[model samples]
Target: MSALWTIFRRDLTLLLFGAPGRGGALLPLLFFLAVAMLYPFAVGPDAKLLARTGAGVIWVAALLAAILPLDRLVEPDLEAGFFDQWALRGIAEEGVLSLRILAHWLSFGVPLMLAAPLAAGLLNLDGAQLWTVELGLLLGTPGLAAIGVTIAALTAGLRAGAALGGLLAIPLAVPLLIFGAGSLQPGGEGGLLLLAASSLAALAIAPFAAGGAIRAGRE
Candidate 1:
């Protein structure tokens, strides 16, 4: 229990503070804001259009933001011999990866949720839309985080793994995007339920998938 707590704290620190060649929590948040800030200019600042389409845009931006840290997630620890050390100490890959998932969600998902309101304002979303958007994100970002880590694990040792990770994560994330953005529409609360289902599915599978990848990489 103590060891797990320690690893979780360590993983959280690495995810938040970041090591060399890895992005910390701030980069994704900034990237998310940048996309939101730029969309208005790209679409000519039409308020009604922005309000109508903005939730979807936020969903896209959030998806992209979630991708930003993929490269940093697993490779750094793999390269630094941390995973090896954990193995030597009898720690299971699943345990480490599970902790990592929690840390990643904290660093990635929570902050994005925190910044959603600002994003809502930038896109001129109304109160109801903002509430739905936040709710959608609350349910969906965990799936995004899970998918990101799973893809990161799968592509960790590859050349241009970050790019590959993004490619891999995007398609898998379509369900979340669909449901998350869908939730902002009129009579779209059902999307939130579907989004939660997707999140639970991802969270359930990620640890095992990522653990397998890490274990396979050991050979």
Candidate 2:
């Protein structure tokens, strides 16, 4: 319990309270906010058009925005030899990884998810559809965060990590994005059910997979 809180608070402080001056963190959050706003600008100015594109725009932006921070996900620990130190501490590596992921999700995922409703307004979502978009995103984004952290962890120690992280994550995330975005279609309630299920499943499975990947990297 204490360890979990310790890791969570440490990452949360870095993610939410860090000075904007730091390049290792905080920059990606700013990017998230900026990308979320671009949809209404590039798509169209009309409210209907904006609403039409709003869910997808915000969804895609949120995915991309959160992912941007993932590149540094484990690179710092690996570079600083903190990974080695942790491994030597007789701690279960999975707990460390899970707590770190939870922290990262809290710092990155929770905020973006919270901000989605407001971004929906920017996208001009109708009141009714706004609720739908919120439902879809809320249920679907944990899957995204899980898959993202898994893939990011896989690629974080590699050379050309940014490009490789994109390569690995883009394909995996497509399904969630599809059904999640599809949920916004008129009479598209089917996709919402699937996306919601996917979210739960991913939450169940992806963390273990991410833990496996992290453990494998150390071997």
Model number with the top lDDT: 1
| lDDT at position 40, candidate 2 | 62
Provide the lDDT at 154 for model 1.
95
TM-score of each: 0.97, 0.86
Question: What would the per-residue lDDT of candidate 2 be over residues 33-137, giving only the tens digit for each residue?
Answer: 677677666766888777777778777876787577666666666677776676677666567666666666676667776676777677777778878877877
What lDDT is obtained when candidate 2 is compared to the true structure? 0.72
The segments of candidate 2 whose C-alpha lies over 4 angstroms from its true place after superposition are: 19-29
| Model 2 error, position 22 (Å) | 5.8
Over 42-145, each residue of candidate 1 has an lDDT whose tens digit, in order, gives 99889999999999999999999999899888988898898899899999988888888889999989999899999999999998898898888888998998
| Structure candidate 1, residue pairs in collision | none
Please give the range of 10 consecutive residues that has the lowest summed lDDT in model 1: 14-23
For candidate 2, give the lDDT of residue 193: 91
